[model samples]
Target chain A: MHFGIISTGPISAEFSQAIKFTDGADISAVFSRNAESAQAFIDQQQLQATAFDSVEALCASNDVDAVYIASPNSLHLSHALVAIQAGKHVVIEKPAVWNPAQWDQVWGAAEKHKVLVFEAARHIYEPAQKIVRDYLVGKKPKTVRLNFSQYSSRWDAVEAGEEPNIFSLKTGGGALVDLGVYPIYDAIYWFGEPDGVRYFPALAPTGVDGAGTLVLVYKDFNVIITIAKNAHSDAPSEILLGRETLRLSSVQGIDLVTEYTAGDEQVLFDSKATPGSRPLSELMRFEAEFFCDMIQAHLEGNFDEARVNRYRSLTLLSRSVNEVCTNARYTAGIFFENETLEISG
Target chain B: MHFGIISTGPISAEFSQAIKFTDGADISAVFSRNAESAQAFIDQQQLQATAFDSVEALCASNDVDAVYIASPNSLHLSHALVAIQAGKHVVIEKPAVWNPAQWDQVWGAAEKHKVLVFEAARHIYEPAQKIVRDYLVGKKPKTVRLNFSQYSSRWDAVEAGEEPNIFSLKTGGGALVDLGVYPIYDAIYWFGEPDGVRYFPALAPTGVDGAGTLVLVYKDFNVIITIAKNAHSDAPSEILLGRETLRLSSVQGIDLVTEYTAGDEQVLFDSKATPGSRPLSELMRFEAEFFCDMIQAHLEGNFDEARVNRYRSLTLLSRSVNEVCTNARYTAGIFFENETLEISG
Candidate 1:
């Protein structure tokens, strides 16, 4: 399989590397809004791929089989739509869109084009998260608490008066949209849509959430989502099952995951590999693998429950998070940079 | 000091044992509405304190210096008011009252009678809690997550057709009112009243909350509260500060509080004691000792800032929790057994 990369940002560069390193896929070409950024990608890495100034030219290149939309959050929907319209498979970063309506449009385009559309939510592919799901198989789970809070350096930039894209509402920035969505996916992927939802968010000066908490109430269990960007936490990026708890010490990578039972029992399932790989690249690799497997299943005329589940789950998960952030902003009386004007959007 | 037992229930029995085992206070008498219940307490304990048929007689007794109100949740207010009016200090178990208005009345009465009113929130008095708070003094605190969920046998009975008084809405029974208040207290005590609050409660068939989640937002921090009475979890009761995190394996007792810090640091603050002393009872002892110290300060006509801080903090904490629960019940259409009855004395 051949993959084209978009944006040439740091994330895109890493994803390009992961594709180059992976067994099944080759980095075919790289595109950037600026020719200089694309040329820099080639010069720095000494890559064989063609550098294109526009996405359309890159999509037209016969060498590319799929396009990876590694652009800013705000551009996910439009970029993916363009790629899907060009009859190419698409893998976009998490938070498929800024809001649900955009996601609906993207989904419609994907269905119309008959091409794979994947949201890169890496934890779903993590072995430890699967362990958490498997642990809940027999027991009648009654409650869940999922926490993934990593204080970002970009938040410090936002605090220092520079408005990074991650802190701008226009770019789908906020702790909820960026960080809390991880736990949201965990909850929905594991437990399905909650009967009800409630959210509380702490906003940056730009009105984007610096931190937030969301509670999803299901019929038999309640899941809590805690996320933050402004401050540090030692929260086990974990899923708390009723009988046993499956936990990861860090969201960046799983060094250790432990399971515990009622009588102070312990089961240590630690992945002893050193943290040498780039986390973002690992996530991109996992996304590509899932996409390849999913597309293969689709080609075989098989309805893969896991693949379809991922699609529907990410759709609803992103939608639900957007609603929570909107509710939080309304309750907090927050106004974003884009709120003051339509800005031809 | 002489202590009069307020109820003959199992909790009251435990209270009597705790007081007996406690260092400073002595059980002078036991009070119950029924003669059989009072006699059972006498038979079981082999105590010299005579049984009283009513709370009024116990309060009026010259031998009783303080009253421990361990009655049904609904009866806390009436019993507390009576004991305070009788010039005896009062130690009321949690859910202190149905509402803050009742709390206000009790506080007013206690002030007029020159007696102290204390809620037996033993977690506040625990050594582990103290250690955590002391550690946060110089550190720039950021986030806190408190979870105290345990499946109760009483709730199982409540769910199975019986409207146990503990599950009775009129009696202040529910997840938010019963178990959720602890996390709320922990948050407000540690961080202070939130700038905003959001609650998501899981309402049971009886209209009582089986479980709930609350997110308290401070200016630059967040506190996530997850609690339940109809579930089980091994998720450590956790507090996330900026510099480090203090995690307890069990929220119910003080054992080993593991502190994990930045740069791969780990410190164990173990207060493991011998078999003669239990963590929960040790908290009760601390509460008693604190009360003794407060009384001494009162006799000296000196206002103790620490005691005043605790009272003010608790009052604010309970008020904030009550506000959120009341709003949530209205929004969720939660019904208690006596919910239809006008909430009045």
Candidate 2:
């Protein structure tokens, strides 16, 4: 399948390289707001691909069969909607969008255009994540803790007051939006939408969350999700599945998986998956292929609404985290640019 | 200086070896209720030391100069007071006694005898701990989380009710008495006594805390401590100073120390502590040498009253955690062997 790459950033470069190595996919085109950045990406990869300066032009291009959206969290709705309208299957990156309104807008457009929309959260596709889900198959998971905190170089810029990008409220950036989404996705995916959630955030200067902790009280198990953009801990990015714990030592970019029993030091099982370097990017490619598969399955009258419902569940989870993050900012006395949010039930 | 080792347990054996390695200390005698156990330790170590079958005989023995009390938590007071009455300096293991009344008795006896009393908490003697203390010389630490939860084999035995030991409330075994003491000590040592504390315990069937969360609210910052006996988490035993955090990988055993700026992942300093060939037993040796150092200093009329006062502070902390754990058990509708703990302060 031919895939269109979006937002020619460092991450996009990694995806393009992974696509070059993948067995069945081709990076057919590149899209960026700046024509030079797109051309630079094409030249760097030395690929026979056209560069489109706008999302509309990229969606209208004949060379692409599906579009991969790696733009900022705020731009996901606009890019996904444009691609769906152009009859292109969609693969959107995390935080899916800034809020549920954008999620609904993108999903509605994808349904009307008969295109598949897959969130490119490679963690969900990784083997470690599968092991976690497998471990919690039948047991009642009573607690979940997901922690992803990486000290970023961009934090230096934020501290120096170089107009904040996605890590600032103006750009829909905060610890919850940027780092908290991983645990949020894990909670909703593993357990289902929580009946309710209590969010507490520690605010940073310049109207963004420096760090935040969310406690999602399920009927049985409670989930604690910690997201931080400013601090570092030795805590691995892990999913605690009540009876056992599924650990990815380097949750930041891990292809390996290990399971630890409730009280044992010895890991029960370990699968150091041979995902050929750049596993995270390969997950992006797999998501793209899955989108094409879902689209074909839908058109041939063999659609699995049950599976589609899972995808819709992803939409709901993505929107829920964005809601929590936005609301946390409001509660922390941080004034965001998008103040007119429609509070949803 | 000469030393008496009370209890022929694993910790005492290790401490005996440590005294042999110390500069000015000798393992003058050993004691246990069972003469066979005391003889076994002497035979195994090839130490030319007198062995006694009871604390009274050991305290009366002229060969002993000081006593290192490594017996179970419940036996600390009786054994330490016996040694003190016989004019022997005493070093008691952590969670020194079952309650504060016992601690007061031991303290009064030591003062009357004009003998030094030491608590064998080895971390305070470690260079890393001194560095951390020096690093925060003038700063009022906002939060201090000291976690020392090792999934002990005794937990399984306690749950089975076979030979219930310290992990059973009937035997003074619980997360608070066993593991919670570390965080309590850290809070007192770093931020002095907290204004208030909130404890959430997962009680065992024996009405002891298996694992739980603790929130210590100080004047400036809130400290969070978690100690679990039934489950394992990769939480570094830590003290989060206002300006930085000092993290140790394990409680009872700290082989490495890392320092991070407050609320940041960038490690300002990390001493990837080199692990020696001898496993956890080496800490006992360090404790022995430090105990002798204090003894000699005291006998030489250079005793530091501040060190003894710090131990008094730790006693107060242990009392507070005891109160909270006892009350939390009641809230969970669990009754233990000693449920009439007066927690009202």
Candidate 3:
């Protein structure tokens, strides 16, 4: 499978690097408004890929079978539509689109074109997720407390009067959309949509949430998702299933899962190559490979039983995650119906 | 201050035992519908006090200058009013009344009779509370997460077809009114009344909250209080004031407080008599002394500056704590305005 890169961002580079680990997937084209950056990315990565000055050019490329949409969040709808119209399977980064209307538009185009669209929420594909699902099969979860807070390295730049897109309100940026989506997706994936949602966000000076707590009210239990980009939390994230508990030392990548039951703990899944030896970048590679494998399986019309049973399909999973994120954002009072965009250069 | 006991419950015994540590407060009279149990209570502790067969008899005793109403929750309002009408100061157990109307009646009678009323929320009087207050002096707290969950020993009795008053719905018993009140009072003490409240409770078979999460929404932040009688949580409760965090190992008594700042932690207060060597019950004694001192000061008309600065008079603090608890309970759908009593014998 030949993949077309969307923007020349750090995530795009990571995706390109991770695709190399896959058997049949390769980056065939790169798209960037600045042609020089696109060319430089290909050269630095030593890839036999063409650089396109426009998204239209990349979408028109016959050599590319799929497109990886790593563009700014606000551009997901427009970019995904371009690839779908061109009959290319697309993989969009986390938070595929801002709200339900945008989600419907993107998925509508994908269905009409008969092309696959995947939201790159790598945690859903991690092996630890399977362990969590299996452990919670018979028992009912009473409460889930998820915290994904890390002081952003880009915050210094923002504090120095630079507009980093991740912290910008105009770019569909906020702690909830950028980071909170992980836990929200986990809740939806595990427990479906909540009966109600209440969000209490600490808005940044730029009118975006710097931190927030989201409550997902279910019939039997409540899921509390706390996310922040202004500070760090050393506490582990956990899901309480009555007398049993599933915990992750960190939610950033869900690299490991530990289950506690009846005063004893067992390590369910440790993504670390060795105990406490895995680097952060290795987890990103796993996410990249998962997305490529998913796209490949979708194209082959062979949705293997294992993959289908775990995540249904890319289209359904993306739609469900996007719906939950949109509803949560609305409840948090961060996203509005008519949001204006001021994308930074 | 000579005190009259309202009931022979375990809490009344705990209160009596701890009051011996105070300088001028003593139990002078005991009341119970069953004269034998009240007499047994005095004899068990070898007290010099007299046991009365009726609440009126104890309240009418000239030897009793104050009353400690440790009866079941449903009886607090009636018993406290009796003492107030008899011109005696009263110290009611935590959650002094069911709702705002009952609270107003008790406070109004106390004000009219010129008698002091105290709610025995011991943690509020602990030195740990002062440390938390001082740490949050100039900082704006972004979120406060409090958990005070303990698996109740009475749950087994309830499951075994026993109607223990603590889990009985008729006696105004449930986790929220009994355990959730601690965190609610903590929120009110630190952040005052919130702008809005949303509660999601898991109701027990008895139709009262077994566990629940309460969200107190402020203009800038939200306080999430989690309380349970159905289970236990080893997770420490926390208050986030930007980069600084104040944590309690447990909110049950807030025996110790730890402050985290800039990747380092310092113990702010440790209630242990010797370093790291205090039993849990010793902390409860600190709470008992606090109430006794406040009552003593009110009677002497010498509100020392330190006591006044730490906690305003018992009247103002009790009113505030009761108001917050009532509002929170109403939001949780546990406390209804038209609730009827079904006190067990």
Separate clash counts for every candidate: 0, 9, 0
For candidate 2, chain B by itself scores a TM value of 0.84
Give all TM-scores, in the order shown: 0.85, 0.72, 0.89
What DockQ values do the models have?
0.39, 0.11, 0.33
Across B164-262, the per-residue lDDT of candidate 2 in tens digits comes to: 675566667777667777666655555666665655555566667666556565654455666666655555655544235567665545556667663
Per residue, candidate 1 scores C-alpha lDDT tens digits across A1-345 of 777888878877777766666666677788988888898997776677888898888888888778888888777777898889888888887767754556678878988988877777766777766666676677655566667666677866876888888888666677877787677776766676667666666667887777777676778666777777765566565454544555666554556667655556565555666532446676556656776666656656684787788766655665665555455454555444454343235
List per-candidate RMSD values in Å: 4.2, 6.4, 4.1
Q: Name the top DockQ candidate.
A: 1
Candidate numbers sorted by TM-score from highest down: 3, 1, 2
Regions of model 3 farther than 4 Å from truth = A153-164, A259-267, A270-280, A298-314, A340-345, B153-164, B261-263, B270-280, B301-314, B336-345
True lDDT of residue B105, candidate 1: 88
What CAPRI grade goes to candidate 1? acceptable
DockQ for model 3 equals 0.33
lDDT (10s digit) by residue, model 1, range B135-184:
66766555678777766778768757887766667677887778776666
Q: Chain B TM-score of model 3, please? A: 0.89
Q: What DockQ score does model 2 reach against the true complex? A: 0.11
Error of 2 at A141 (Å): 8.1
Instruction: State candidate 3's TM-score.
Output: 0.89
Of models 1 and 2, which has the larger lDDT? 1
Residue pairs of candidate 3 with colliding backbone atoms: none
**How far out, in Å, is residue B344 in model 2?**
4.3
